[model samples]
Target: MDMPRPYRSVLYIPASKERALDKARSLDVDAIIFDLEDAVTPDAKVEARDTLKAALKEGGYGARAKIIRLNGLDSAWGREDAEAMKDAEADAFLLPKVSSAADVEALAAIIGKDKDIWAMIETPMGVMKAEEIAAHPQMKGFVAGTNDLAKELNCRFRADRLPMITSLSMMLLAAKAHGIVAIDGVYNQFKDDEGLAAECAQGRDMGFEGKTLIHPAQVAVCNEAFSPSAEEIDLAERQIAAFEETEASGQGVAVVDGKIVENLHVETARKILALAEAVSAR
Candidate 1:
């Protein structure tokens, strides 16, 4: 398996705001999405595109993966946005409302195979076709757009997020099946640290690689929540040691912390350790 990239907190910065773009350079985020859609007003779309081009040209984002979220191909600004940023120093192009494999193919055609493509699975159609979209050769990741999904589903938002659970699960399954990263949607309440923490924990349990953030304030919390805890690291180390000892003795199972440790369990423990190492290295 490919080593997992540390994507604990992917922050979204509106391309239209120069100050926000400048501020992002100093933010401790795993990745920054320079957004040209949704965050940019329709009237300011062209200017935002120009601003993003210049920002990319300036090139000060260190280590943090730089991504550009373009308007949908169906939208008037989408093509121009992609064309303008084609040579920009970005790691990926995030396409909003991607509902099929063809969408990925079409985007790959425009952006070329050199850049990664992160698709937003926002609508009902997107969720339904997630597998096909994920299987696309050019797809690099999936970002769940829970707010738009809620609007499309006409479902009430709850603290537990019961209504969108199915859609989230489907996206996660597809991402894991295809070995691509799956990012949870943004938490609307940026001020609600408690709420954001809860949601982050939920997303981590649901197997999401990270959470898409709307504010820099949420970065630390999201990063901490997604990363393996110290206790978890210690436990994983113990599990690996125990499993190795047992394997040397020709035993198929080992015991760690009064729990049975098998090959599958050891594999999971190793992944946790690898994730911790990856995060620390970053």
Candidate 2:
């Protein structure tokens, strides 16, 4: 099995801001989303595209996965944006407001199958059709756009996120079922470390691979939150060892921390260790 890529802190940098892009090179982030849609103003769209192209050509991202967020295909600059970045050395292309499998298929056709496609599950239709979209061969991940989803649902944002529970669960289930990574939406409040931490923990518990971030300050917190704790690593090692010992004895289960550990549990424990190693290697 392929190890999961660490996406605990996916930072979004506006393509129009050269200095921001420059600063991002040194930040300790797992991934960077060079945003071309909402972050770039209408007047600066063309300029942002040019700037992003030049930045990609320079190439100093190192281990961080480079992703470019494209505007909606219906937007004026969408086609041109894809054309500009088609040759760029980015990891994936993120399509905004993806509502159906056909939307992903159309973009995949335009961008070709070499690059991974990530869909934004923000709209009601997008949530409803998430399964079809997640099952697309070209789609590598699903990003929950909670801000837009909130607007579409006409629900108020709350710290508890009670309003978004169902939608988030749907996206998570779809991604998990399809074996694609599911990333939680941005926390928005960059200064609220406590709030961000709580949200990050919540996302992690919800089976999200990571959280999208709007500011660089949120990187460390998100990384720390999503990573396997030292205690967790220790437990995983113990679980694996016990399970193996039991299997050698012709048993199918073992006990770890007063709980039963089976083959499937061993698989999950191994994955946790694999993820930790992957992140450390990066």
Candidate 3:
């Protein structure tokens, strides 16, 4: 089996900003999304792509997954953005406001079938067709675009995110089903570390591999929330040891802290340990 890649904290850095791109190299982030979409003004779109391409060529980001978020094909500069950076040193290309599998296919057509595609599930139609998008052969991830979804759905923002749960679940389900990464939306309040931590905890509980961040300051909290805690790491180890003992004895289950450790639990426990290792390696 392939070792799981940790996506605990994915930060959006505007491609046009040279300083921000350089600063991102040192952040405690698992991935960097070099944004060419909403973060850039229309006039600077082409310039941003070139800047990002040049920056990537100069290379210093290390092992952090470098994802480039492209403008949608519906936009004037989207095709050009993709074409210009198709050969850039990026881990993946994020398609903004992806509404269906066809959107993914269009990017594939432009960038060729070998490239990885990550979809932004922020529209009502995008959430509705999430399964189709996730099933695309080139699809590698789904990022929740909660801000846009709320705007489109005409829903009020709540700390509990009650309005966005259904949509979130749909996108998450699609990603989990297809064995792709699912990232939670940005927690807009940059200065409110408490709120960011709370939301990050909520997202981690909801099975999101990571939270997409808007600011560099948010990286520490997001990584802490998503990573396996010491207690969790201990428990995972115990579960694996106990389960292995039981299996050697020709049993199908084991007990750890009064809980049953079946094959599925062992599988989860091993993944937790693997993820911890990945985070440590990072």
**What TM-score goes with each of the models?**
0.97, 0.97, 0.98
Candidate 3: tens digits of C-alpha lDDT, residues 1-282? 356789999999999999999999888899999999988988888899888998999999998999999998998988988899889999999999999899999999999989999999999999999999999999999999999999999999999999999999999999999999999999999999999999999999999999999999999999999999999999999999998898789956799999998889888888999999998999
Q: How much does candidate 1 score in TM-score?
A: 0.97
Ranking by TM-score: 3, 2, 1
> What lDDT would each prediction earn against the true structure?
0.92, 0.93, 0.93
lDDT order, best first, reads 3, 2, 1
Shift of residue 156 alpha carbon in model 3, Å: 0.9
Model 3 ranges with Cα > 4 A deviation: 251-253
Candidate 1 per-residue lDDT, tens place, 1-282, comes to: 346679999999999999999999998889999999999999999999889888888988888989899999999999888888888889999999998999888888887887789999999999999999999877889999999999999999999999999999999999999989899999999999999999999999999989999989999999999999999999999999999998899956799878999889889998998899888888
Model 3 pairs whose backbones collide: none
Give per-residue CA lDDT, model 2, range 66-125, as digits (tens): 999999988998888888888888999999999999998888778888779999999999
Candidate 2: regions farther than 4 A off:
251-253
Q: Which of the two candidates, 1 or 2, achieves a greater lDDT against the reference?
A: 2
Count of clashes in candidate 3: 0
TM-score of 2: 0.97
